[model samples]
Target: MRCSWLLLLPLLAACNSTPSAVNEGTVSRVADRQGRDTTTALPAPDTAATKAVSAVSDTLRVARERHNFSHAEGPSDLFRLVFRGPSILEGNAEFTITSPEGQVIFREMLTEPDLEAALVYEMKTPTATRAERETFVLRRIDRFFLPAQFHTPALDAKAGFPTDIANLERPTWDDLRKRPDAIGFEYLKGKEDRQRIAWSPLKKQVVRVQ
Candidate 1:
């Protein structure tokens, strides 16, 4: 017999919140293992509840993804990342990562210009409407993070960089290679640029993996 499990985890927001931090992880859960398939998913949101929230609170209702990108050897060290914005048209977003303790570890903004740049990949209709452009940007944020975007062993098996670049890469490169099983998340810039990022316990911050 096959089994299906829906693991319900609490969201990173509380009843009331501040712009700087959240009290928990993002709201959403993936079907971790179901009949041999492990696909992350977003649960349907409550339509009425969504409408009731203030603009700042409304952002989390749009999209979220959760994963344990921890490189340490131990029990699963899960983390939550959630994106919020005023409206689909604004393209002004705040993506926050909540640590296990429900504290905001990192927060960054997705400016209007930053999101508009991706419109080159989205504009199928020439001379699109303002609403259309807004919708396109919102969809881009929704699909920003994905399961395939993370790596299991975060270091290149064998890759080279100039002396200066290598100097910057060596710390992360050496640390992850030793374990050969460290996991990290990849963030893309522009079309093909890739950056792998992971939590640095020693440094107590999120850092890039070269």
Candidate 2:
């Protein structure tokens, strides 16, 4: 029994001498002989991989916008779309629309060019500053879902469409014009190409209007 007690002392001394390890945040560390955490941190914390970026924040700039663009639905309808991105001048923006019941109705990823396209019309001179461009984008977003942006008479039944339009699309235009309550939002691509789009109840999807 005395010999067994003597052997346990060496094992206990060795155990006490060994350091203890710990992990905190992204850093790993050890305890010193005095039971203090080591000042030295293994590897390093990278500056790039910080917090997960938010919907409108890029860890630098921030932006967000939302609007109701309901046409077929009444005033009480909850149909709406949300825009999220870093800012008006940088990063791609995501536009997502959902139905009253929270089903995704439409979604599109818009580049910086798409949000800033209206700036071309305002940039009559090369002197346009960064502030001016940003303001234009803000105003564009405000009008994106406005009543004026939504055209009631999407198509003229008597008028002829461009020959370049696909033959299959002609029927869609014809069908839309017949519905008096149909509404579409007209938008400009780049500088001049104008197009109109609407959610078609008949097709249960988005449709283009002439």
Candidate 3:
């Protein structure tokens, strides 16, 4: 028994003295060999990686502010990144807003005027009084309706007026004619409505005039 006890003493001491190392994230630690653990942390990120991360964060912040959407409340699919010809921004691009399920909510030619109207329409809330309440549906029509395409200029000129636009309670066709570049149309659903008209010289699509 005494001899067996003597043999186990060295093994026990070896076990107690053995060195072990642990690494986690930026830290590396060595234990036991020197009777204490030593730790080292990884170096800071390089300038390029820091800049890349900051730029991406800034882009996301700008997009959310532009759409008036919040990362905490709204879905992540609010915006679609699209690349189009320069004309698209020169009041010549067409766009469609669809529901998450692919249901068409609105479609129209994006004109400079339409952008302003849409902004006003989105920013204001309807009031109880009819006199104070303004439905920018006519101003934001491009958000909802899609125009029909045509071949020749003559046919394009004669596509008439859209029934949806004609059905509006106010703002006659003559009022719309003043803004010749405005070509988007108004829409009315159960509890929602939108109206817009703009004429774009570059637009080949025609809206039937009633």
Candidate 4:
């Protein structure tokens, strides 16, 4: 009977020393058995919200694709570059003049309404550097623009250009001086805004408008 009691005592000791099924090891009750947060589960996707996001994304993508940033023309080096377009997309316009010898004469960003007034083709002094005054002929002139809508005439076979437009002749320097805008003390007063003549003395290019 004493040997059986000793065996039972050994069995009770073994049961007390064994690890428990409800382990208090490094884990929290707030987390599940898989270690995911019980309180912060991802909600089911809303179909309406997904459609709204998709629609906005498509709209922005199409707008980016449909944008036309380059639309302008220019003349040869002997003639001045004439750029005329609707004023709406004129903001943030860039004008680049490449030389015949594969050099960039000038690349300017102009926000003004008129390109002639915005840029000075010739240098004030003869001792200026190449960047200030390039002698190379204007090989190419490129104009770029930001995205904006412009109204223009629709192209059609029956739509012909109007022939009633009058021919314009270039005015002389003497004719420019006779104008009221170029009259007495206008240049000294810093009010050359209304000057009808824009001439490049070095390039021998002159443009006058009434």
Question: In every candidate, how many clashes are there?
Answer: 2, 0, 21, 0
Residue 62 alpha-carbon offset, candidate 3, angstroms: 22
Write the residue-wise lDDT of candidate 2 on 60-149 in tens digits. Answer: 223333333345655323323344555667756555566556676776665667777768666879677889877876665555555565
What global local distance difference test value does model 3 have? 0.36
Residue-level lDDT of model 3, residues 92-196, one tens digit each, is: 234543334444343444443443333433455553233222233222333332233211121233344455654332234444344433434333332333333
Once fitted onto the true fold, the runs of candidate 1 whose alpha carbons sit more than 4 angstroms away are: 1-61, 71-86, 161-169, 189-193
* TM-score attained by model 3: 0.23
Which of 2 and 3 is the better model by TM-score? 2
* lDDT on C-alpha atoms for all candidate structures: 0.57, 0.60, 0.36, 0.30
Global CA lDDT computed for model 2:
0.60
lDDT of 1 at 95: 60
From the highest lDDT down, the ranking of the candidates is 2, 1, 3, 4
> Where in model 2 is the C-alpha error above 4 Å?
1-83, 162-168
Kindly give the stretch of ten consecutive residues in candidate 3 with the minimal lDDT sum. 60-69
Residue-level lDDT tens digits of model 1 in 1-210: 122222222233442444232223333333444545343334555686554545435554345676665535544443333444556655366666666566666666656556556577656766778887777666666676778877776666665532533324556556655655666777554444556676665556766665
Worst 10 residues of 1 by lDDT: 1-10
